[model samples]
Target: MTESAPTPQPDGLDVYVITYDEEGHEERLLPSEVTDAVVERSRDFGINKGSWTIDRIKHGPLIAAESQLRLVNVGSLARAIAGNYYGTALIVDQTPPPIDEDVYDIDRRYDVDVVDDVLVAVVTQRHPAQPAETEAEIAARLARIAAAYGCRIVGVSFALPGGGTPEEMLSHWPEGEEWSERFRAETIETLAGMAHDVKVSIATDDNVTMATLMDGAAAMADYLSATQTGPLDAAGVLNLLRGGHFNLLIGEAESGYLEVKTQMHPISAPGDTGKKAKVELAQDVARFANGDVDAVLVIGYKEAPGGANTIGSLTPVADSILNTAQIHELLDARIVPPVDGLIIEKFVVTATDSVLAIYVPKQPSEMQPYLVHGAIAEGKVEGAFFSIVRRRGEGSITTSAQQIHAYIVAGKRYLRGND
Candidate 1:
């Protein structure tokens, strides 16, 4: 079978081919700079004498080291890729050009990295020589990067002295943004109200060796896939609790057993975001309990929340704000049948910020549908109200009467010993 030919590249765009000379010094040569020796090596690699194409230019010395392609011209492919990536970004690091009519280049002060399929932006403080970046500046930078990359910004991680993911995960309180409660980038998400045009994570206050971050991210990725992790547990979760592993969860899509909540609920306690804490807690716990599989509720993570509730970024739930005791209380007061063997634990992300993970175990068939007593509205708890929630994929669905009836029938038959 014949293979498709490589697409032709446009001419005179200053595209170059790089290879090293015998002296071992780096050499970046233009199409016109292709030397006889370099051409010979290209032929060895099966990039024969023909019109050069994008793929050829891209792959010529990209995999040099492992393959020992040791072509000096390809000395630093990453810098090369970064430079030519979407119109000479590498050249003008200082004054980045506009990506398009609307989106532009990110500020040089901040660095963008694709860590474990998640886009992580690190805020290296602006120069003391220059005025510190303004709140508007940070917001504009986030919006630009999000739009330019066509992905959401996973909030900032301030790596300070010593260990521990610090307050607000260090998301807030940048040199100039110290006073604002709402993060600058978050405003961009609020205005756009969507993933595309622009969006940033709900800021979490925290960071990492990044080793732990990668491991935790790998684990979260597995947990997000139903086929991969059928039911959730603490083993994999413990890894995530270490370092700034939560950052790896950025952009992860929610699943049947995985839920990421941005704020703590107001359950006899002052909370950050949710007013209907009781109802929210009841519904969330009951949803997972009633499901066929076990699940977890992660407080401190935000959802981009389009069709699929994508785990957008972190909104740190500090221990001072919410703790295991509060979670235990809410679960006990809200869900019926007691969510047998349910586990509530806390991990300190930073000294100030923490995450609460509520693990709902898969109960026996007799405990088919766990219900939540509510009559709750806008933070008020009325008498004798109940809700039956079940998880279906990434959403909490109402318990179907058919399934409820089936469970009832099964229970009655079991009681009658009519097997």
Candidate 2:
């Protein structure tokens, strides 16, 4: 027996979103809607989309600490904008009380969701900050409103320009000693920290990001003392870490799960040039629903202020638990991995009296993607797949059946396509 050298097969994909541009132009800034969808997918499938992806949903929730309200609100807006894909945005600041209908209308027009307490603003597809709203004003206003509304907010995620280097951002820094040089470097690190907090929260427990906030003073000191260029440089460093740059795993256990091995890197959200690190770790648990592995485990890491060459902040580990309860809700298949390009088959099975003929791919590779697309399009899983239902006086039964007429009709079309 012999062991083979490990070849690099991307452990998994990091599907991030890029902004849209004119028909033949480069995509620079993603709209808010697209970002929302990406976020939703990340939550559902463990993938990272732009800074904030998952615009499909009305509003994405971001929990911030009391002391950090100003930046958190700004981040919420940033997330909404980056995810929208279309030039529409809706931002709601829950702390305030007057329901802003105009804002809601704007968000609805562009299919973006921004709902907070009473301050909701819906922005339609348009050039970002067309009338010239400076990032500082926005941040300060949000901070003021949050205070008035009695909500303490902090922590932010989603995408922003690398180091918040846009004109508006640069204009806002206060008069001090050589701020320009420092501003460029510090903003990137700040944004990275914000993104890191968001990732840590979603991937692990909610309180984990908060706990780190308690150590803010110490964290700030360490970060200030570090010799690194800033978060942007840290991102490059993280990539180096990814490349066999370091050879060790670090982290602690989740609330009630076994500790898993981990790795951390500062990878930016898709399309954003910021220096936020994308933390990846390996988990010991396997997610098998019915004697079959469905998901691969990866640990996420975030950088602690000035902590370098050490476990920065340990984001709580998500219990490597499989969503087995919803197994019945999924369209089961025995398809080849999508990367392999195998065929899929559609069929059904029988248990008690009822029969369910599922729409399975004749070729394995075709099945999974088809199911995913169908689920996205139709909300309900269609085609030939196993489903559990509680029938009248029949208790719960897993049944299979065949619709010969419809099946034949669709099958003919399927054959035609293949032919």
Clashes of each: 13, 71
Q: Which candidate leads the pack in lDDT? A: 1
Instruction: List candidate 1 stretches off by more than 4 Å.
Output: 1-238, 242-244, 269-276, 305-308, 376-381, 400-410, 417-419
Least well predicted 10-residue stretch by lDDT in candidate 2: 278-287
Per-residue lDDT of model 1, residues 236-296, tens digit only: 4434544335655566567877787888776664542343666778788788887776677
What are the per-residue Cα lDDT tens digits for candidate 2 across 1-419? Answer: 89999853322213223443445442433223453333322211111323322222234432221222222233323343333324333222333322333332211221112333212322122222222234344334334223322232332222232333234454566546575668766764554344211100011111222222222222222222221232212223223223221211132111111121233222223532111121010001111111111211223333434534333332432232212222212223222122121111111111211111111112332222221211111333233432222112111122224543455577799999999
* TM-score of every model versus the real structure: 0.43, 0.17
lDDT of each: 0.49, 0.26
TM-score of 2: 0.17
Best by TM-score: 1
Q: What count of clashes does model 2 give?
A: 71
**Which stretches of model 2 miss by more than 4 angstroms?**
1-127, 131-408, 414-419
